[model samples]
Target: MSTDTTTEPEDASLEDLLARVDDLETRLADLEATPDDSQKMVVVATKGTLDMAYPPLILASTAAAFGYDVTVFHTFWGLDILHEERSSALKLSSVGNPNVPVPNAIAALPGMDEVTTRLMRKRIAENDVATVEELVDLSIETGVDLQACQMTIDLLGYDEDDFFDGVTTGVGAASAFREMVEADVQLLV
Candidate 1:
């Protein structure tokens, strides 16, 4: 004779199951009605050239305007973007940039970077586009968190006072990583 192994379900009545379902539905509806958390955006700015500086600032400012919590983590060359004096004096690299419209040979000339920067500044002025300094100011005013990497600061021999007024200097990479990990949108520029 074969052993009878089939077991009936636990004594869960229809009304009990329906009540549990109703409770779960109520909880789901309450959760659905709750407001969503704010979105977060993080950008890692690794370039300090005049041309390279715009993207992170622009994006950060725009995201802030859209009600996103925005952070721009400046590391390596990007630390210059937060430097009060250097930000304004950032120069466009004439060599190895395809958008410069100059051949690499010609762009490598001694004064070509200065010339390119001058021309670009002129074009920007003519077009009424904001300068790097102006964009940095705007980013600060718009509540974009500007974080300067601590290790880079030590390596480059930069003091905390070297950065702009609103910049958060001496931030470590691990802190930046935490922010990036929690960010809804992350970019490396």
Candidate 2:
């Protein structure tokens, strides 16, 4: 021991490190015994024009499938996606590009948004995609929860009951924002 006196400091440092390692081992065991955190996901949809819908609800539904508690909050143009009577009226833009896959291509020509929508309505029988209405039907069948923004609904003079069946209530922006606070993942689709 006297010959290796210089190594005393190294021995003491090693002992201290070993003690800390033991403490960490206990903490790791405790954590392993605890339950996993419940994952959260929030999806927001905006823009109700042709070809712009289906983002938030689909993403939310998919996230919920992965065991994450999912919530979809619709606002502004996005709210149109959840309309019970009007959702079927939605169309896709197919202008300037003929090969693009759109529900109703004629609905988006130069300053012809409205005209395109009208044309789409006339040809609804022949148009390919099932339209937003069809998607909503399938979405509801899969147990997806859809929520429309209260502020937007009121602003647009839409009745609360007029939204899709899955929508139970309308919520203000503050409440929507609060819902995202605990979310492990939040996205604006």
Candidate 3:
């Protein structure tokens, strides 16, 4: 003869498990109803070049237009995009850019960057594409958060006044990281 020794959870333990599940479901419903339900995007801009500047700004503005909460964190050389004066005068470098038809030898020549920038500007105008300044303005008007890194600003000796009117200057990396952590989309440009 054989005896079965299987055991089941106590009735009290099963009741406790059901109660915990109920609490969890209630908390989840509350979270789903909160304002945090909106989609979020965080874009990290680390390059200052004119060509490099467009991607982040365009993405941020587009996301904002689509009703997503968007934040652009500009650090290192990327801070130039927020600089009121520098942004307007940004130039595209032909050197080391594979897209440019010019050979590296000729691209390395003096004034090539200026020529490339002029050509790019003409193309943008011909295509009726918005300039960097216009995109920045639109992003601001659409409520996209443009944050400039405090460390980069201090390192470059830039004052808050140097940035555009709506830009949030002197923001720390930690704050940007917090936003990134909560964002549904994170981009490093």
Q: In order, what lDDT does every prediction score?
A: 0.91, 0.71, 0.92
Among the numbered candidates, top TM-score falls to 3
Candidate 3 ranges with C-alpha deviation above 4 Å? 1-35
Residue 117, candidate 1: C-alpha displacement in angstroms:
0.6
What tens-digit string does per-residue lDDT give for candidate 2 at 1-189?
A: 485776888898899999999999989899988956878777777768555675665566567678777677788878888887767666555565454444434535465555656666666548664556766665566555567888889888899888877784657778778878978888887
The candidate, 2 or 3, that scores higher on lDDT is: 3
Which pairs of residues clash in candidate 2, taking residues 3 or more apart in a chain or in different chains?
107-116
Query: How would you encode candidate 1's per-residue C-alpha lDDT over 75-145 as one tens digit per residue?
Result: 99999999988998899898988988889999999999999999998999999999888888999999999
In each prediction, how many residue pairs overlap at the backbone (N, C-alpha, C within less than 3 A)? 0, 1, 0
lDDT of 1: 0.91
lDDT of 2 at 160: 89
Question: Where in model 1 is the C-alpha error above 4 Å?
Answer: 1-36
TM for every model, in the order presented, reads 0.81, 0.61, 0.83
User: Model 3, 48-150: lDDT tens per residue?
Assistant: 9988999999999999989999999999989999999999889999989999999999999999999999999999999999999999999999999999999
